[model samples]
Target: MTEDASPRALITGGSRGIGRALAAAFAADGYDLVLVARNEERLEAVARELECGYGVDVTTVSADLTDPDALEEVYERATAGGAVDVLVNNAAVAVYGPVAETDLEAERDQVRLNVAAPVELTKRFLPAMLERDSGHVVTVASTAGMRPGPFLAGYHASKAYLISFSEGLTEELRGTGVDATVVCPGPVLTGIHERSGRGSRWLERRFMRSPDAVAADSYEGIRAGKAVVVPGLRFRLLPWVSRLLPRPLSRRLARLIIDRGDPLESDR
Candidate 1:
């Protein structure tokens, strides 16, 4: 398609990491971009870079999804130009350490961003897509969602919610010219883990794949119409393999991985 005629994609958390990488992938394939993030400066920079490199239209909307009003603002600003052909619910947050010790409100905000934001955004965008009889919704869940996540209990549960959220949509949207894909990536070499306060250099180097790798895989899978995508080969199989083991042992294994190779606690 021509530049102006190209489809548009709105990606939450598109200022950096997987979101940005996915933006690049879509732009390369001739899609315009609407990027959402909290940092205005960062969002603009990515928009500029993508526009300069790909010659596609790029718009930036800075909003924290945890806020109740943010979704309305995003819907208004994002759809202003035209219909969003693809909505990537890629923004999310997590709290490390024990749940009781972690701030309750912060955990709640995580739920809002991880769960509510996507649900609301989907509600807003999917209708337009359905009316047009075309669109895609891609949500980035995590491999942690497939199993137990200990130190990151809130994060783990939130991802599980996303997995189910996307899958339910998948079944509902079939044959409607609209599709949904859920991306379940393992530890990715991004600021999300560090921002979560895990901040493990070993986790960065040892257990993680680059966000670009995941983004590329995600884009290809999405194009080929795959319903579920796990970015890495090892991470793809880990979830199902863990299921064969007992529940307690599976939880411990998940804990060990999330701990980024730290010593494990005595099994409860």
Candidate 2:
């Protein structure tokens, strides 16, 4: 779709945080919106706010993306007959604590939401985009994807798969008139911490970027067809520095950054 085209954007997890910010940004840019999330009430509120603020069409689909059937329905609801022009795969789950102690089902759900859903949704929408020869796919991966994370193993792995998938898709769509951008954001001030049972105001205040800033950069980068969008300069440096350091040293550094609580004391 060209600049003049009135594109439609589908954003998963659009009820809050970066997804919600992106929805508002796109609406202001004159795009019709399909906002997806598990919370129907919040989705409706966001939809109402966007429509009222930007005077654009907005639709909300409430479905658990971890479920394959629900994900299929979400894809159909958002992109029926090739109407969608931009896809933001932002839905994710974060399960903290040790891998052995963590709930296996929760870890599996993270994979289902963060990895499988995005791939499946892309598979469903890619053909239409190829046929039309125009569209953008933005996957909200994370800097955690650049290396293995000790405390957030499952979450990191899921984002790593997204990063690799998006990178590969960018290569395949080289001449297909479709573009994919993967956003690797570092710590951001969002409800994810609370949702994952890792809420810490002090930690967030010290280390996270504002959700608004991350959303703005992501929207601009995706619209400009950039392949990999790393928002902050600090995070942009992390991947390179991690590559330079030895694996063991890099892992220790990651643990220092991502691990919360008193380091001198045991987690218990």
Using TM-score as the measure, which candidate wins? Answer: 1
User: What lDDT is reached at residue 259 by model 2?
Assistant: 71
Q: Can you tell me which runs of candidate 1 are displaced by over 4 Å?
A: 1-4, 201-204, 260-268
Model 2 accuracy (lDDT, Cα): 0.84
Best by lDDT: 1
Against the true structure, what is each candidate's TM-score? 0.93, 0.92
TM-score of model 1 (CA atoms): 0.93
Candidate 1 structure quality by residue, lDDT tens digits, 1-25: 2245889999999988899999999
User: How would you encode candidate 2's per-residue C-alpha lDDT over 102-219 as one tens digit per residue?
Assistant: 8999988999999999999898887888888988888999988998888788988899999999999999999888999999998777757556775544554577777788988887
Give the runs in model 2 whose Cα sits over 4 Å from its true position.
1-5, 200-204, 261-268
Please give the TM-score that candidate 2 achieves against the real structure.
0.92
Model 2, backbone clash pairs (residues 3+ apart or across chains), number: 0
- Model 1 misses residue 19 by how many Å? 0.3
